[model samples]
Target: MIVIGIDPGIARVGYGVIEKQERLIRPLCYGCIETSSHERTTSHRLHEIYTRIQVLFAEHSPDEIAVEELFFTKNVTSAIRVAEVRGVILLAAEERGVEVVEYTPNQIKLAVSGSGRAKKEQVQDMVRRLLKLEEIPRPDDAADGLAIALCHINTLR
Candidate 1:
């Protein structure tokens, strides 16, 4: 099974693809979609996000998509923007007929690091260890995306 995991944000949306087979999970791809901060238009940024995700769906051909659910302690504005990005990702997946699953940040952290309250570095380290990668993915968002994918893979077992 191939799964695409998303960590949504208005400025930079992160995505990771994983292929699972017979108890093995392999990283297929991981990256962030960055929008221009100087563009002076939120709509343009949103359009860029939508278009990029659409292209990613086509390129990866994932059977399913797993995305992190919003968990905001504060900053309602940030949460709303992230939610909008998440909606765009879901729309793209739905249009392509891909199954969508949502997971919380704590759920992903626990699945990846065996602790719900694990630090970001811990989750990233475990992701590298489990995937047998030599280095952790950069910019934090990519690692979070991979963690989301790992959570889904672990849950299926």
Candidate 2:
């Protein structure tokens, strides 16, 4: 099975693709789609996100998509912007007929690191180990995206 995992954000949305079979997981691709903070309009940024995600869906041809569920405390504005980006991602997946699954941060950490309260470094280390990478993906967003994918694959087991 091929899965695409997303860590949604307005300024920088991260995505990872993985292929799983017979208890093995392989990283296919991972990267962040960045939008400029200097943009004068939020709508343009959202449009860019939607268009880029649509292109990614086409390129990856994933069987399913897994996205991190929104979680916020003490920053309603940030949460709202993230949620907007997530909405575009979900819409793109739905339009393409891809199955979508949502996971929480704790759920992802637990599945990837064996603990719900695992540290970022721990999860990154485990992802690198599981995928046999030389180093963890950069900028944190990519790492989180990989974690989301790993969480889905682990849950299936």
Candidate 3:
């Protein structure tokens, strides 16, 4: 089965694609969709994310999409913007006929690192070890995407 994990945000939306067979998990691709502040409006940025995510779905044709649930944020404006971006992501998945699964940050950490309060670096390290990668995935957000996907895969087992 193929799974795509997402760490959604307005300025940067991270993604990772993985293939699972039996007990083996393989990373297919990992990256981020970024929008510059120079963009005209939040709507335009969201449009970009929506378009890119649709293209990704077309290319990967994932069986399921695993997304990180929104956590509490001190900044209300940022939280709202992230929520909007996440909505666009869900819409893209729905349009593509992909199943969507949401996992909270704590759930992800617990699944990935055996602890709900694992540090960022600790989680990243575990992702690297689990995937047998030479090094940690670049750009923290991309690693986070991989973590989310891996968390879901583990939960299923």
* Lowest lDDT 10-residue stretch of candidate 3: 34-43
What lDDT tens digits, residue by residue, belong to model 1 across residues 59-101?
9899889999998979999899998888888888889999999
Candidate with the larger lDDT of 1 and 3: 3
Q: Per-residue lDDT for 11 in model 1?
A: 86
Q: Model 2 over residues 14-86: C-alpha lDDT tens digits?
A: 8889999887789999999999979348899999999999999999899999999999989999999999999
For each candidate, the alpha-carbon lDDT, in order, equals 0.90, 0.93, 0.95
- Give the root-mean-square deviation of each candidate in angstroms: 0.9, 0.8, 0.7
Q: Flag regions of model 3 displaced more than 4 Å.
A: none
Error of 2 at 83 (Å): 0.7
Model 3 local distance difference test score: 0.95
Q: Candidate 2: misplaced stretches above 4 Å?
A: none
Candidate scoring better on lDDT of 1 and 2: 2
- By TM-score, rank the candidates, best first: 3, 2, 1
Q: Quote the lDDT for 28 in model 1.
A: 96
- Residue pairs in steric clash, candidate 3? none
